[model samples]
Target: MNTATTLPRGPGRNGAPRRGAAWLMLAGALLLSACTTPLDPRKDASLQQAAYTTDRPVVRPTRSVSSFSDSLMCMDHMLRAAQVPTTLITSKQVIDYSSRVPVAAKDMIITSLSQMSRLSNAFRYVDYEVDIVRQDTVQNLTTILLNNNLMQLQRPALYVSGAIAFVDQNVVTNRFDAGTSASRLDTGYSRNRSATVIGLEMHLGDFRTRTLIPGLDSANEVVIGSGSQGLDVAGRIGSYGVNFNVGRDYALGAGGAMRTLIDLATIELVGKWARVPYWQCLTLEQTHPDFQRQMRDWFDESGGVGQATLVQNSLIAQGYLQAGTDLLALDSPALRTALTQFQIDSLLVPTGVLDFSTYERAMRHFVTLAPDGSLQRVGWGPSGPTGSMAENKGDSTPVRTSGLVLTSTTPPPRRIDMQIENALPPGMEPTFEVGEQVFVSATVSRTSHMYCYFADPSGNVMRLTPNQVTPHSLVAANQALRLPDWLVPNPAFIMDASRPGTERVACFAAETDVLPRLPAPLQGAGLVNIPGYRTIEDIDKAFQQGVGTSGYVKSEVYWKTQPKKAQPAAAAPAAPQPAKR
Candidate 1:
C-alpha cells in the first residue's frame, strides 16, 4: 500500500464541473430562442406613411383633378333626359402618335365607361361581344334553322369614340462638384428632369342617324413631370483611396405618367358628353339668352285650341275651378278671372291671358283618373295618358262634371319592418359558395302588399316574390315567407361563377299595391335581362312619383367560389436497404 497524494482544492470550489451549470446553459439557450429579432421601423412602415411622425403630421398631397366617380355623377345630374341604350367600341389604337401608350388603354376606357353606366343610370350598356356569320342573299329557312347561332340583337341609340396623342416632351439635367483641400475629399452632384404632354379628343354621335351630337365633342391636355439627383465623393491618403456614390431614382415612369393623362382625359370626355354646368355640359351657344327668347316667342305664337283645352283641364284638376268649367269657353270672363288668380298665387304677373308660365304651372298639377275613376297624382311627360272622360266612351259623365272633388286627404304614417335571413348550416359566416344551394327567407312586420327583388353582381334585378308558387304579392302580417318553399332548396337563381360578389335584396311594402311599374318581362317572369334597378335611388324615385305611400328596406349577402384544395404529394420510396442486410 502506497500513500496517495491529495491535491488541495480551491476555496468554495468543486473538484468537478457543476451539474447546475449545464442546466444554466440550457436555460440561457431557451431564453435566446424565444427572443425575436427587432424590426427596423423605416423598413416596416409603408412609403406613404414613413415620411410622417408624431411631431410631423401627415399631409396628403393634393391635385387639382377630378376623379372618375365625380365626373360620372356630374354627368348623370346634368343629363336629366331618359336613359339611352348605348354601345362603346374601341379602335385598334386607343392612343395615336404615342409610343408610351399602354396596350390595355382601350380596355381601360371601355371598363371605365361601363362602370360609369352603372353608377349614373345615364346609359344602358349592351355587350358588344357577339358572333355574326354572313349569309347569302338567297338563304332558305333550312339554312337559318341549321345556324342556330342567330340572335335578335337590340340596337343601341348612341355611340362613343375617342383617341389620345402625345403632343410634346422635354428633359433637362444639371451637374455640380465641390472639394476641400484640407480633408482631401471631393463631392459631385447631378440633377435630371423630364416632362411630357398628352392630348385627347372624343366624339359622341347618334348611332342610327350616324350624325354627331351638336355639343358632344371635347379635347383635353395633361402634363406630367419627373426628376432625380445624384452625388459622389472620393478621397485618397498615403496610397490608399476610397470612393462612394449616392443617387435618387425618378419616382414615376413613362407608363404611369401616360395612365394619369388617360384618366384625366376620360373625365373631360364625360363632362362634355353630359353637358355638366361648370365643366361645360352645355355650351354657351346652346344656352344663349337670345336663342332662348326666340324659342319662347315661337311657342307662344303656336298656341291653338289644343293648348286652350289643356289649360282648362289642368285648372280644373288643380281645384281652381269647380266642375262644369267649360273647355270650349276659352274667352269666357270666368276662365280669364281664374287664370289671373292662379298667376297671382304663383308669384307671376297677373296676366289674364294664359301665358306659358301659367300653362306650365297648371300642367304640373294635372291629375290622372285611374281605371276605377279615382283621381291620382302623376308626373307630366310627353307620353303621359290623358284624363278626359270623353276618351272613355262607356262613361257618360262629361270631363267638367267628373273633376276631382276638393277634400282633405291625409295618409296614415306607418313604419314597415323587413328582415332577411340566410337558411344554411350555421357556420363562421353566412356566405354562399358557387354551385352550393342558397335558401333565403323574408318577413314583414305588418300585413301589406310586398314587392321583393334582388340585384345581382352584374346589376340585374330579379323579382323574388309573386312567382309561380307564391302568386300573390300580399304577405301576412308578421309572417315569414321562406323563398323557394321547402321542396326547392335553391331559389330560381343559382350562385354561378360570374355572380361571385355581393348581392343586394330590396323590398318595398305598402297598405296598397305600390310596386313601381316594371317592364313586361319583369312583371310576368320576374327576370331582368337589362341592367335595370341597380341603384336604390332609382327605386326610391319611382316610389316618390307613384300613387301611394310606401316603405323600403335592403340587405346584402356575399357570394364567392371556394378556392380548390391542393392535393398531397406521394411519399418518396423508402431508401434502398443496405446490401447484404
Candidate 2:
C-alpha cells in the first residue's frame, strides 16, 4: 500500500512554485490567443481530404415538369385539329399574396402556351410590359428622340390576367399522442398534421377592345397538407436523467401546388376559348358528362362539312377509306360503303350515314389514334432536295379548257382520285405478281397542278410524275393521266412491282402550283426516292405541311404483290418405255 504525503502550502525557495504557476498561465494565454487566428494547415495538420467532405457527386439538372405536363401536350393536338390560327398574346404579372408561391406566374403561362402550340403555333406571346418601368422609360426615350424606327410593338390580340385569389392556411388540423410510463422511465409519441387551401383565377381579355371575354375565365384550387411526428423517452434515477427524441415531417410544396393550379387554369381558358374537347386531356372517358357536353359544343361549332372531314380523316387512318378522298363529298358511294363497313366493325347500326353519333365516335378516336398509334409532337420541315420550282414546268402538251373561269366567289373544289391503271373489276384494290409491270392513273376535279409519289414496300417513296419523259404536271380537269403516259414514246419512267408487300400511290392536286413548296424529294427530277417518308402517315404529314389542310386535295390507292407461284415443270413425257408398253 502506498501512503500519500501532503506538501506545504507555502512557496518554495525563490518562490519557484508561484513562478511555475505563472508560466502555465502565460502558456495557456498564448494558446487562447492563437485560436483567434486560423492556423495554417501547412503548419498544423496534414493536408488530406477535409473532414466535412462527402463522397456524393453533383446532381445533373433535368427538365422540370408538373402533373399536368402531358395534359398540356395533348391540348396542343386539340388546337391543331381545330386549326386554330396563331394570335399574338401577352400577360401581366400575376398577383399573389402568398409569398411562399413562386413569383413566376407570367413565365409559367408563357411556357404552358408554348407547349400547347408545339405542332402549330396557336399563340405568339409578345413581351410588351414585362417590366412596366423599363417599358415606360423606353417609350419616353423613343418619343423624345422623335425616331419612328426606334421601336415597333406588335399589337397583341389577347391579354391574359390572373391572381392567386386566396391562400387559406391551417384550414384543417389534427394531432395524436400516445405514451406508456414505467416505474422509473417515461416514453411518449406525438403526431400532428395540417392542411392549407390555395385558390387561383385567370381570365382572357380582348386586347384590342380592352375588354375581358365573357365565359373565358378559370378558377381552380388545390389542397396542400403537411404532417410531422416526434417520439421521446426519458429515465431518471436519483440525480441523473436520460431522454431521447425523433421526429418526421412531410408536406406538399406550396410552390408546386400553385404551379399546378396555374397549369390547370391555362388549359381551361384556352380550351374553352378554342371550343375543343378539353376533358380528354384530364383523363376523362368519352362517357363522362363533362366530355359529352364539350363534345356536343364542338359538334355544334364544326358544321356538316367539318364533321364529314373529321370522319373521313379517321376512316383514312383506320384503312377503311382511301387516303385523299374528298372531305366534302358525303354522297359518294365509296364513302357510304366505307362508313357502313366502319359502322359494322364498330358494332353500330350500319346506316352508312355520317350522323352525329357516328361523328362523335369518330372524333373521339381521332384525337387519340395515329397510324402506328405512337403519335408524338415532333418538328418537321422540308429535307432539302436539289432542284428549283421552275423545273416543275410541264411539257408542251395541247391544253384543254372547259371554258370555266374561276372567281373569288367560286373557289375550285379540292378533289382528287387515284386508281391502278388496269385494276380488275375497275374499282377494287388490285394485287400483282412480283416483278409485274404497274401503272397508276390520276384525275383531278379541276384544272390543277398535280404531283404523284409511289411508296414501295420498303418504305421508300419515289416521285413517279413530273419526270423527264412526261414533264407535264398540269392536267386538264376530268382527264385521266396514266403514269409513263402511253403518249410518250420510249418512256423511261417505269414502276415494276419488286417486293412481296403492299405499295401505295398518292397524288396531290392544288389549284395553285404547290410542287415547289413540297419536300425536296417530291420536287426532284426522274424517279428519285423521297427520304424519311416511311409511312403513309409520314407522307400525309409532309403534304399537310406543304399544301396545308385546305390548299390541296390528295388521293391514295394501294396495291399488293406476292412471290410469283412457281409453275411446276410440265410433267416429263412418260418415258418411252411407257409408250412401248
**Candidate 2, after superposition: displacement of residue 330 in Å?**
54
* lDDT top scorer: 2
lDDT of 2 by residue, 1-581 (tens): 99999876666565887799899999999999999978677754443555445455554332445657657877866775565766789998898877657668888899899888654456878865645454687557755554567566779999999998988999999999999999789999999999999899999999999899999999998899999999999998988988989998998887767767777888899989888989778652332223445556656666776667556756665555554556547888999987876665443577888876566555554222122332211111022111221112342322222222211124335577665544254344688889888876676655678877788788887777777766777776545567655435577677778899998888877766787887886677758776767766686787799879888788988888989989889877865655554
- Which run of 10 residues does model 1 get worst, by summed lDDT? 402-411
lDDT of 1 by residue, 117-193 (tens): 43223444444532234234334443464478564445676666667655576633344545444467766777777
Among residues 3 or more apart in sequence or in different chains, the pairs in candidate 1 whose N, CA or C atoms overlap within 3 Å are 275-281, 276-281
Candidate 1 structure lDDT = 0.52
| Residue pairs with clashing backbones, model 2 | 324-554
Global lDDT of each model?
A: 0.52, 0.69
Question: Against the hidden true structure, what lDDT does model 2 obtain?
Answer: 0.69
